[model samples]
Target: MTQLITERSTDVIAAEINAIKFQTQSMMLQASSEIGKRLIEAKEQLQHGEWGKWLKDNVEYSQSTANNLMQIHTEYNSNPQAFGNLSYSKAIALLGIDAEERENFVQENNVEEMSTRELQKVIKEKQKLEKEIAKKEADALKEKKLLQQDIQDLKQQLEDAHQQSTDHEDSEKEINRLTQELAVAESKAKKLEESLKAKPIEAATVEVIPESVQKELDQLRSKKNESTDPAEIKFKMRFESLVNEFDLTLHALDGIGNSETKAKYTNAVHKLMDKMRATLEGGMS
Candidate 1:
């Protein structure tokens, strides 16, 4: 019982662990998606810079104002109106991107590439892997079920073989006993004929009761009755067939020798014969 409980507990733990891994995997992908969204949103606002050629080409501004705006932009972390408040669109115009090298690094990805076509390809692949894992788990379950079914089938076959052996043994015994009874009865009939022949023509013949004869008569009748009962006869016949079958099985198994099956079936056959004999006597008495 304790072992069974332990096995069940392990199975439950394995199921829980799988669930947690799947959920954690989803969360990790979601985090990656959040990073992609953040990068895209910052793209436009980082286009313009306060000290860029755009400012020199457009309105002439004091170097000090530009310098102050640059400080403000750095301080505000890319806000256009960094001094107080600013719209994201205006901020991006003044600061093109945070760093030219970093922006270039982000642009190296080929938009036409397969990896870039779908935003959620990684998640889809993860799901596909999960499906393959699930299929493997289901296959394991099927294999275990098949093994259990084989065990059950073997158990039932063992029982049947045992019963067959027992019935065969009983029939053999009954046949032996009836043979003895028939021999005795034939001897008595022969004696009776002899006595009739030896008697004198004028002498009166007296029949003699055999000594201790009740038991013998009962044995003879029982044997005849066993032959007449369809069920008993059927059992006897089947038992003979089974014995033949058992011999063949034993030969085949002996070639393979000392296997679990051989020992199991042999024991089953003995048990069945004993059971059958008991049942026969039980029914008679």
Candidate 2:
């Protein structure tokens, strides 16, 4: 029976100790909140430039400590009941979180049950995660902007290509029309030649042609002389054909995406240009 009594007394003593511990913690939290509140009031009442001096002389506190207390008061004064049992160290550690989120964080993580170090660590990790997520979101937004710009550029290029294709079709149609006109002119010229050959020259008094007709004949003779100039016609035709071929080559080059192949083609064009330049220089000399 004595042994049983001793065991029960031991259990009662342990419960009392736990209760006292709880009460002591609560009192400390209340004291801290009160101190913070008084600090805030004192700071507001003090002169603008006298805060640091007042803190140092009157309260024997550093500027940092005073700032911390004022921040704590601002964050916790309104709802001290929610955090009445928190220790001073834990409250200070929890200050890392925003005031609105602090209560929820404490409830969710059971911060009251955790050590100050653990709470600080958890807050640090949360801050790091938030930073990482913010950075990623910013990067994603930047990439999205860049992608949109690229899309816009591609759209403009496509529109330009469509316009160029329309112009090419028009040029082809013009070339076809000119070719048809040339063929008809050639057929008429052949018939006229045959008629002239079949007609015999009759002796008659010289008849004066109209001034407009003489002028027309003179223009035709001049045009015939120019057309029969072999070197000039050959030079013009060769130059036009070469220019067309070079334009086609450039279009083909634009289609090549491979850097190495494009570089090779570019080098070949450079060499050809150098050779042409040298030939032209020799001819000029």
Best by lDDT: 2
Q: What is the lDDT of residue 281 in candidate 1?
A: 100
Q: Write the per-residue lDDT of candidate 2 for residues 1-285, one digit (tens) a residue.
A: 455543467889999997888788788877766788898888788789998998888889998887777776788889888887788888888888988898999899998788889988999988977776566445435534543553454355445545555556654443443333333334333433342344321111012123564465445323432343445444443543454345345545655789999889989988998999999999999
| Model 2, total clashes | 0
Pairs that collide in candidate 2 are: none
TM-scores of all predicted structures: 0.20, 0.54
Q: Rate the local accuracy (lDDT) of all candidates.
A: 0.43, 0.63
Return the lDDT, model 1, position 55. 42
* Tens digits of per-residue lDDT for model 1, 115-223: 3324145334545665665664454355345435533543454445445545576655555434433443344334333433443211011111223343443343345
Off by over 4 Å in 1: 1-119, 166-285
CA shift at 259, candidate 1, in angstroms?
A: 41
